[model samples]
Target chain A: MKVYRLRIAVQAISFIILIYGGLFYIDMGNRMPTFSCAYVDDRGGGCFLIGFQHMLSRPFGEFLGDAGIRLLKAMGIFALWSIVLNKAWCGWICPFGFLQDMLSKIRSFFDVDLSRFGWITRTRYKSVKYIFLVLLILIPLGIANSFFGLEKIPRDWSVPFCQICPARVILPVFNGDFSQIHIDFSSNTTMVLTTIVMVLVALFFTTAFVKRRFFCSYCPMLALLSLFDKIGLLSLKKNGQRCTRCGNCSRACPMEIREIEEEKVLTNLVTQDCTLCLRCVEVCPEDKALETRFCGIPIFTASQQGFLKRQGLDEESHTNKNGA
Target chain B: MIKTVISCFMALFCLFPALATAKAAQPATFMWLEPMSWDAIRAQRAKKKAAITKVTGGQQEAPNPAESYSTSQDKGKKRAARGARPRSYYLHSGEFPQPDRQQSGRPARMNGQYNHRAKPKKSQTQAILWVKYPDNRSLSFAPKQRGPVSLFSFPAGDGGWYDLFAYHDQGVNNDSRIHRYSYTHFMSHGDSVDKHETNGIEGPGFFKGQPILEIKRLCADDHECYRTHAGQNLRVQVSFKGEPLANQTLTLITEQGWKQSKRTDDHGKVSFLLIKELFPEKIDRRKSENYLLTTEHVLPATGVLNGQPFHHEHHIATLPLQVFPPKSDWQSKRMAYMVGSGTFLLAGGAIAIRRKRQRKAL
Candidate 1:
C-alpha cells in the first residue's frame, strides 16, 4: 500500500473535521494537542496552548489549591492525547500542517523547485522550538506573579503566544471570520505582539513556497510532542543489519531530516523532528530495513517489491512482459 | 411710599429664586435596579470616608461597609480580611440616584451603598426571579427580610447571560401600578463554556408568563450580544403583554447622567447609538460602565384593587446594561491594514529576490 496516498486522505479528512465539525455539534474538547485555533467561531476543538497559558496566569501561591489540580488535569489530558498518536498529530491531524502541505503541493504542481537549508543552519535551528516552548511557559507565569521583587508583567501580555501565532490570524479566515486581523493599540505590549503576529503571518505565506513544513520546525507543539516520543504507543523502527543504505528516504523527507538514513544503530527511528509520516518506510528499498510499529505490531514494512511497485517498475510485471 | 414698594419688589424676587431652586431639587421617583461590582463599591466607600474626613477637619472617620458586615465568627473575619468582593449584584432605588459622574465633570459617585449580604424583603419574596438562558429555567431564591436595597445572587453553573427580573405590583390611591426591573449579567468561565447558547432565543419571553410591559435589547444572532459597547447601534423592543407596545417613550440614561429619550415606532422598536463617553485614557478596559434604559406604559382601566377604584394602570420597566468602551477608542484597523500589507509585500519581495539569486547561483 502507498503510505503517502493513505496519509493524504487521512489529512484531508482530519482537516474537514477540525475546521468545520462544530457545525455538526462534534466537539472533541479543548485539550487537543494540535493547532485547532480557538479563535474560529465554530471550531470543533481548541488548541491546548491558549488554555495552558491562561491557567498559568495566576499567582504561584494559588497553585497549591484547586488551581494546581486543574492545571494537572488539563496537562494530563493533553499528554494522553499526545502519547496515543505521537507526532502523527502533526503530519496527520493539524489543520495548519495540512495547509502547509497543500501549499507545497501547489508549488510542486507549478514545477517550482524546493530550496534546502544548509546543514549548519538546520542543526542550529533545531533548538528554536525548545526556546519557544520555554518562553511560552515562563511569560504567562511572569504576567501574574512578581519575580524577584520585580513588578508583575502587564495584563496585555496575557496569552502572549496566541497573540503571536500565525494560525490565530490564518485559521479563522477559512471560517469567514476576519476579525482577528486587526492590530490592538490598547497598550505597548499588545501593539508589539500584534505586530509580530502580522510579520509572522506574512512570513508564513512566503516561506511555504520555498520550504516544506516550514513553520513546523519552530512550532512549540512539536517540542512538546517530542517529550512523549519515548513513551508514545506508535513508533518508527530501523534495522541496522539490512545491508544497503540508499538515501531515497532522506531525499524524500519533507522536514529534511538526515538521521533516518545516517543512524544505523538506533533501533527506534522516532527522532524529535520525525513527524512519523512513514515516507521513510515507503522509500526504503531494502527488505525489512524500516517499519512502523504500533504497540509491538508491525503495521507497514519496507520491502524491495513494494517500493518497486510504487515506483511503477515492478520486477514481476517486467519478467512476465519479457517472457511473453 | 416709593421706598416701601421697592423693598417689597426685591423680597418677592428673592422668593422666586428660592422657589425655582426647590423645584429643581425634587428627587427622582423611579425605582430602578443597579448592578455594582465589588471593586466599585469599595472605591465608593473609600471616597465617602475621605469626604467625611475633609468635612470634619480630620476629626472623624466613617464606618466601612466591610466592617459593618463582618460577624464575630472566624470565617466571617477571614472573609473580610481577604477582602473578597461579593459575586452578586446590588439593587437600589432612584431616590438617591448615584450618578456615575457629577454635573461638575467629576468621576462617578457610586454613593448608593447596598449590602450585598442583605436578604430580600419577606413581602416581595417571590417578586424576583433569576432566569438562566438556553434552558430558560426560572429559579426561586430563599426568602429573608432585609433593607430596601436587596442583594441578588444566583448559581451561575453555566456561562451565559443570567437575567434577574424583579416584578412588583402595588395599589396606590385609586390606581394600580406595576414595576418590573431586569438586569442581565454575563458570566465567563472559560473557552470551554458555550457562550452563544442563548443567541437563537429572542425577546423576554423565555419564561412561562411574560410581564405586563417588558424592554429587551434586540440582538440578532450576535455572539457578543452579551456585551454592549459604545458607538454601537443598540436596538431595544418594548412589548405589552406579549405584543408590541408602540409609541412608548423610552429613555436611556448613561453613567454620567446623560439621558436621551425616543419614542417607539409602530413595531415597538427603538434604536439608539450609544455615545462614546469613556475614552481610552480615562477608561479601565477591565471594568464596564452601567447604562439604564427605562420605559413606562399607562393603560386606562377601571379596576377595584384593595377596595379602591383605579382609573389608570401604570407599568414601568427598567433594564440596566453594562457597556464597554468603544473598540475604536483603542483599535485601529486602518493602521493594521497598512502594517499587515506592508509586511506581506516586503516579505514577498525579499523572498522573490532571494529565490532569483538562488536560481542564478544554480
Candidate 2:
C-alpha cells in the first residue's frame, strides 16, 4: 500500500480512538487511559498536556507547595508521550489536526488553489504559537497569584487558552455537541470570554476550510511539542549536496515550513516546525536526496522513479515526456 | 549519543518529583458510622450484587471503597484487618443543640469561695456543639451552660449532605494528658440512614460525653448552608467539658494548609472567622469539597473533667467544611444549546457552499 493510504488509515483509527475511547463499558476494577484531546479544556480530568498547562497557570506559591507534585506528575506524563511519538501526535493522531486535513482535502476536491504565504509571513506566524504557550502559562499564574491575596482576579480567567481553542468548538461538533459555541451569560467575565470563544470558533472554521492547517500554525501543543522535537525517534533527513533546488518538497509541505527547503545539515534536517508527515521526503525528486528515519535507521527514501510511480506515471510516460 | 543520553537523564530526573511526593498509605480503619438493619444489609448486598454484575457481568468481586485507595495486593490485608476487629453496634446519635434562650441560675455562692474570675476548681462541663454550613454561616453552643440545646433542622429532602461533627473530651485515664476525641458524621438528607455511604472510619475509642476537644461549624437559626453560595465569613468555635482551662491558644488549619489561630475568651469559646477565599483547586469537588479544618490546643491548666482530673497537653479536632449548591440561572441553558447548534450548522453550510462555488469555477 502507498504511504498516503497508510497514513489515512492511521489517522482515521487514531481519531476514533482519541475521541470515542471513553464510550467503552468497562468494569470498576479495569481502567483505560483517559486519552482526550490536549487542546480541550476538560477541567484537567483528561489530556496530560492541558493538565500540565493548567497546573503551571496556578499561583507560584500553590504550585511550589502542594500542587507542585501534581504538576510534576502531569508534566512527566506529557513528556513521556512527547518522547514516544513527538510531533507524530500532531500529524497523525490529533483529532483537530485531522479535522484540518479533512478540510484541506475538501478544498482540494473543489480544485481550490489557495496561495501560500511568503516565507517571511510564515516565519512571523510561527512565533504566534510561542506567544500562545506563554499566555497559556501566564493566565494561570495570574489566577494563582490572585489566590495568594494579591488581587481579586476574575475566576473566569481560569483556563484562558481553552476558552478560545478552535478544537474546543470544532471537535465537539462531530458528536453533535455544539454547546461549547455558545456565549456564557453567567458573569461579565464569562460573557466576554465566551464571546471571544464563539468568534474564534467561527473564524477557525472559515479559515481552516480555505487555508490548509491554518490553526496548527499557532497551536500551543505544537509549540510545546517543538520544544522536545529534537529528541523524537522519527525524523526527516536531507542531503543538501545532492539537491538541485527543485523546490518540490517546499511546494508539497502543507505547513509551508521553509526550513526543510533551506536546511544544509544532512543529519538534523527535521526542524521545529516539521510535523514528520514525510511529504518533503516523498516529493524530493533526487535519489538519496531525502529520507525519513526512525532512531537513525532510514525507513523510507525519496527517488525520482518512486515519485513518478506515486503520481500514477509509469516509465513509459516519463520517457515520452523526456522525448517531448 | 551524549545528547540523547542527556535527554534521557533529564526525563528520568523529572520522574523524581513524582516519586518523592508519593504519600505514604495510612492504616485502614473500621468506617461504619451509621447503624444498619438486616433489611438494610440485604438491600446493601443486593445493591452490591447488582453493581458487581452490572460492572463485571459475572465477576465475583464486590465493589469496595478500600479498593479505590489501595492496590489489589493491599486488599487482602485490609480485609483481614477489618475482619479481625469487632463490629461497632451503634453510633452515639445525639440531639441537635438549640440556641440559648434563657440564662442559667448561678450556684448559690458556695461559701463565697468559688472564684468567678479564676478557672473552675472542679466543674463537670458538657460538650459544645458547633455547626458550619455553606455561605460561611455557623452556630455553636455549650450544651450544658447554654439555656437549651438549639434544635437545628436541615431541609429533610433537599438532596444535600450535612456533616455532623461531635467532639467531647475522653477524660485522662491511663495517660497523664487529657485525651480529646472527635466524631465526623456525614448525614445526607433525603437518603435512608441504612444506605451504606462510607466516609473514613474513626477507631472505636471515640464515644459519648468524654473529655475531648470538640470544634465545629455552627449552622445559624437551623438554616442549612447547603443552599447558599460559598465565601461567606463564618465562625468556628472550639470548646471542651474539661476546661483545658481558658485564655489559651487554639490554632485552626484548613486543608490548603491555611492556618489561623485565636485565644479562648473567658467563656471558653475560641471562635475564628473563616474568610472563604479561593476554592481548594487541587481536591475533587464532586465527592466532597469538605475542607478538612483541624485545630489542636494544648491544655494550659490542669483541671477536673467529669471528676476525672487531667493535666496539661493534647486537644485536637478536625471539622470538614460542607457547602450547599450555589444559586445558578437555568433558563439560559436552552438558549445556549440553540445558539451553539445554530452556529455549527450555519458554518457547515457556508463552507459547503463556498467549496461548491470554487468547484464550479474550476
Candidate 3:
C-alpha cells in the first residue's frame, strides 16, 4: 500500500479517537504529546502543555521539594511518549495536523497551488517555535515569582500558551461547545490573550489554503519534540552511496525540508522539520537509497520498482505495451 | 423639574437605611447554623491568646461571656452586640488564618495553650454528619468549637463532593413541638474524581433511612452543579423520610438580607432564578456571595422522644449556595463573534489581494 494512503487511514482513526473517544470511555490520559485539547468536552485525551504550564506556575522555592519531582515525573512521561513515535506525533497523530491535512486535501481538490517559503524567510522563521517554547516556560515562572525586582505577573497569565492556542477555541466547537470563543473582558491580561487567539484562529483558517501544514511550522510542540530527534526509536536513514541526487524527495516533502535531499553524508535524514511522514522515502527512485527504520531495522525502503508502481509507470507494463 | 426628581431619589436613598433597620429588627422565627466569618474567628483567637497570656503573667482573667451565655435570649443579645446579622447556614471554603504564621514572631511556650498538643473543644450546639465520596461512608461528630463558631477539618480524601449535614435538634418545645434545624453543605476539594459520581448513591436519601427532613438542590446533572451562578434557575426539593413534601414554604435569603419565598409544587421542587443582588466592583467580579435557601415543613403526626410526647414536628432545612457573578458581566459572546468574523474577513481579503498581485506580477 502507498505510504500516503496508510497515513490518511491512521490520521482518520486517530482523529476520531482523540476527538470523540470520551463518548466511549476511551481515556488516553492527560499527558498526550499531541493536541488532544482538554477544552474539548468529549476529548479522549488532553495536551500535556496545559498541565505543564500550571505546574510551572509556582515559586522557585517550591520547586526544591515535591513540586520539582512532580514536574520531572510529568516531563519524563512526555519524553517517553515523544521518543517512541518522535515527530510522528505531529504528522500522523495531532488532530490539528489532521485538520490541516484535510484542508490541504480540499485545496488540492480545487487545484489551488501550494506556496513555498523563500530560503531567507524559512531560515528566519525556524527560530519562531523555539521562541514560543521559551516564552511558554518563562511566562509561567514569572507569574509566581518576581524577576529582577519586577513585580509578579498576574494570575490571569496562568496557562499562557493554552489561552492563545487555536485548538482551545476550535476543537471545543466539535463538541458543540462555543464557550471558549468569547473574549474575557474581566481583566486586561485575559482580554489580550483571548484576542490573540481570535487572530490566530483567523490565520489558521486562511493559511491552510495557500500552504500545507502551515501551522506546523510555528508549533512549539515541534520545537519540544525536536530535542528527542537523536534518541527517537523511529528514524529515517539515507544512504550516501546512492548514485543519483534527482531532488524528487525534496519536492515531495510536505514540510518542505530540503535537507533530506541535499545532505549526502548524514545517514539520519530525520531533520528537525521532518515529520517522519516518509513522503521522501516513498518518492525516492533509487533502490535502497532511503528507508524508514525502527530500532535500526528497515521497515520501508526506497526501490525503483515500487516508485514506478506508485507513479503508475511500472516498467513491466511499459515493456509489455512496447512489445505489443 | 430635574432637581425635584433628584431630590426625591436622594430622599429615598436616605430612608433606605431606616427601612433595612426596621426589617432587621423583626425577630428570627427559625433557628439556623451560621459559620463564623474569618474576621470573627481571628478576633476570637486573639482574645483566647490574650487570656492565656494573662494567666501566665499571674493575673486574674475575666469571666468569659461565651461560656456564661447559655439561654436563647443571651445568644440573641450576643449576636446583636456583634452586629444584627441573622444566623444563616453557610459552608465557607475561604482562607483561614495560619496559626504558625501568626505566632512566628512570638517566643515558644511549653503550656498546652496555643500549641499543637492543645485539644480542640467540641461544640455543644451543633453536630456534623460527614458523608464521604465514592463509597459514601458517613461519620458523625460534634464539630470542634472555636470561639462562637464550630470548625471541622474535612479530610478531603480523593477530591470529590463531601456532603456535610449540620443539625441541631431543640428538644420538645413548651408547646410539645419538636424543632429540628438541619443544613446540608457539599464541599469539593480537588479535580481528581469524576463529578458525575456526585449524583450516585447520594441524594435526598443520603441520611440513611433516618426520619430527618432536608432540602436538596436538584440539578439536571452534576456537571451543571457544584457551583451555581446568578441568573441561573436553582431548583431545590424538600424531602422528609426520603419522600417529597409538597406545598412547603422555601425562602431564599441573600447575603444582603434580600428574601424571596416560594411554595413547592406537587413534586416538592421549587425553582428560583438567582438574581444578582450584589453589583460588585470590577476587581470583585469573580467573588461569590452566599444565598441561603430555608424550607419549613410541619408534620401533624404525634411522636414520642425520650418519654416526652410531641404533638407535631417542625423541621427547618437550610442549604446555603455560593452564587457567582453572571457570565454576562465579563463575557461578551456577541462581541467575540463580531471580532472573530471581522478578523477572518480581513485576513482572507489580504491573502486574496496578495495572491492576485503575485499573479499579475507573474
Candidate 4:
C-alpha cells in the first residue's frame, strides 16, 4: 500500500512538472521548443517523435508537424508500463480518472451506489466509451479545418476534469498570480458554472445510486489505458493452499473484480483497471495468501505460508520452554 | 539514492533544452540572402526608382530606332542596310513608367549581367546581337504593329550564340513604355543536347545545350507582388523555329512582317515574357478581363530528323493574356456571400453533428 501511494504521487508530479518546465522556462520565439505540452496546438500528434517541426514536402502529400506522430511512440512506453502495472494509470494517476473519482465520491455523499449493475446489465453501454474517445481523438485528426481543427479536444470534452484542474484554474488562484500562464480556450462556453452544476449533480447521484467508480467504466482515458493493461508487468499472485472463504479482499476491490484469494493466475488475470491500489492486500488478514511482484521480484514483503509455519513452530518451542 | 536523483534531475534540466536548442540552431545555419518580407525591404529605405534605373540604365534604349531607320532610308540605301537592328518602341506610351531600379526590383547581377560571363563568341551560324541603342524614354507611344518580337542565337560551343533575356526595372508602376533592351547575337554548339557550358566557358559547366529561357516580364499588376515581381512590361518571349528554318543560332524570320531572325528553344518552343496588362473592364460586351500578349515561334519549315522524313506546318502562338482586374462590385459581393455562407453552414453543421453524437456516447 505504501509503495502504490508513493509511485502514484511520483508519476502525477512528474507529469505536471514536464508540462510546467516546457511552457514556463523557455522563451525562444519562432522556434517550436520541441514536443509541445501546449495540447492546444497539435502540430501533428506525432510531433512527440520529431522533437521539432521540420518542413518536409514532396511532389504531393498531406503535411503536418511532428507533434502527434510523436505520441505514437508513447504506445511502446505504455505497453512497458502495462506489462508491469496494468491500467494502473487510469485508476490512480490519470487526472481525468481522478476527476471522475472525485465525482463518484461526491455521488456517494448523495447516497447513489453506481456499481449496483453487473455484467448482465447491458452490452450497449460498452460501445459508448470507445465512441467518445474516437470522437475526441480521431475526428479532429481527419478534418483539415474542422472545429477540432486547431485546438485540443481534452479541455473541451473533459469538462469536469478541466473545471477543477489545479494546473489551470486552481493553481493560478492558489499561487496568487497568473502572468506567466497562457491558456487558449478551444470551447466557446464558460466552464466554472457548468463544472459546479455537474459536480453537484454527481454528488447527488453518487450518494443516492451508483458505485463510486461507475463513471470510470466509461472514461475514455481508462479505455485507452485498458488497452495497455492487456500485457502488463506487475501482477497479483494468490496461493491456493492457505486460501479461506474470506471475501474481504474482493469486497474492497475498486473495479469490482471477483478473484481476491482464489482468482490467481501466472499473469495479471484481472481487468486492465487494476490500480495496484493494494486495498485488497491491506484488508486481507492472512497476507501470506496474496503477494505483489514485479517481473517476479517481491515488491511488497508478503507474509507467506512458509514464514507463518516457521513462526508457528517458534511459538510452540517458546510454550514448551516456558511449560518445562 | 541522492546521486541518482541528482543525475536524473540534471538530465531533466539539460536534455530537453539541449534537444530544443540543437534544432533551433538550424535556422541560423542557412543565412537568408534575400529579404523575407516587404516590410524588410521597405525598412532598408531603398529608393525604388534609383535602384531600378541602375539595373536598366540605357540598356533598353533604341536611340529612336525609327528615327535612325528614317535617316538611313533618306541618306541613301547603303546606310539603311547598316541600320540592321532598328526597333520602333515609340508606339508604347503612357502604358508604362520611366525605367528606374527603385520602382522595379532588379535581378541580382554578379558583374553587370547575370549571363555576361556566359556569353559566346561570333560565328556565321551564331546570331550575334548588336544593340544599336540601350535606352528608351517614352511613357506612351502608339505603334503601327503590335506583333511578335524576333530573336536569334548560334551553336553554343563554337561561340557566337547568346540567349535573349529581359527584366523589367522593379518599383515601376504598370506603365510599360520604358525602353526595352534587345541583344542580337550568339554562337551554336553542334549538338542540341548539352549547352549549359556556354557561359564564357566558365570552368566547364555541369550540363549541356543552350537553353532557350523564356523571360516573362511580370508587370506590377500581378496580385502576389505586382510591386516586387511585376515592373512595367507584361510579357517577353524568345523562339527560333519554323518553315523558313532555324538558321545559324537557330534564328527565324517572322513572316508576320518581322524580318529579323528569331532563335528557337531546344524543344523548338518559343520563349516570351510579358507584363500581364489590365484589360478594359467587362462593362462592354467585349470587355477583356486581362490582356495577355504572347507569341509562339511558328515553324517556317520542316521535313525530317536524322532520316525520318515528315513534313511540318505551323502558326504563330498568342502573346496577349486576358486580364480580369478583380472588381469590387455588388455582383462580386453577392456571389461571395452566397458561396461563403452556404459552405460555412454545410461544413460547420456536419462537424457539429459529428461532435454531438460523440459527446453523447462519451
TM-score, structure 3 vs. true: 0.76
Kindly give the number of clashing pairs for every candidate: 1, 23, 0, 164
Better of 2 and 3 by TM-score: 3
Worst 10 residues of 4 chain B by lDDT: B27-36
Model 3 chain B scores worst on lDDT over the 10 consecutive residues at B92-101
How would the candidate models be sorted by DockQ, starting from the highest?
1, 3, 2, 4
Q: After superposition, how far is residue B361 of candidate 4 from its true place, in Å?
A: 33
TM-score (all chains, Cα) for each model = 0.78, 0.52, 0.76, 0.33
Across B240-357, the per-residue lDDT of candidate 1 in tens digits comes to 8779988999988876668899999999999989887644464455566677788878778777766677788777777777788887776777877788788879987887788899
TM-score of chain A of 3: 0.96
Candidates ranked by lDDT, best first? 1, 3, 2, 4
Which TM-score value belongs to model 1?
A: 0.78
Task: Give the DockQ-based CAPRI class for model 2.
Answer: incorrect
**Model 2: reference contacts kept, as a fraction:** 0.10
TM-score of 4: 0.33
DockQ of all candidate complexes: 0.40, 0.05, 0.35, 0.00
Shift in Å, residue B60, candidate 2: 56
Strongest candidate by lDDT: 1
**lDDT-superior candidate, 1 or 3:** 1
Off by over 4 Å in 2: A25-35, A38-45, A62-66, A146-152, A265-267, B1-362
Regions of candidate 3 where Cα sits further than 4 Å from its true position: A64-69, A317-324, B1-123, B129-142, B151-164, B169-206, B209-214, B218-223, B265-267, B281-284, B300-312
Q: Which is the winner by DockQ between candidate 1 and candidate 3?
A: 1
Indicate the worst ten consecutive residues by lDDT in candidate 1 chain B. Answer: B77-86
Query: Which is the better candidate, 1 or 2, if ranked by lDDT?
Result: 1
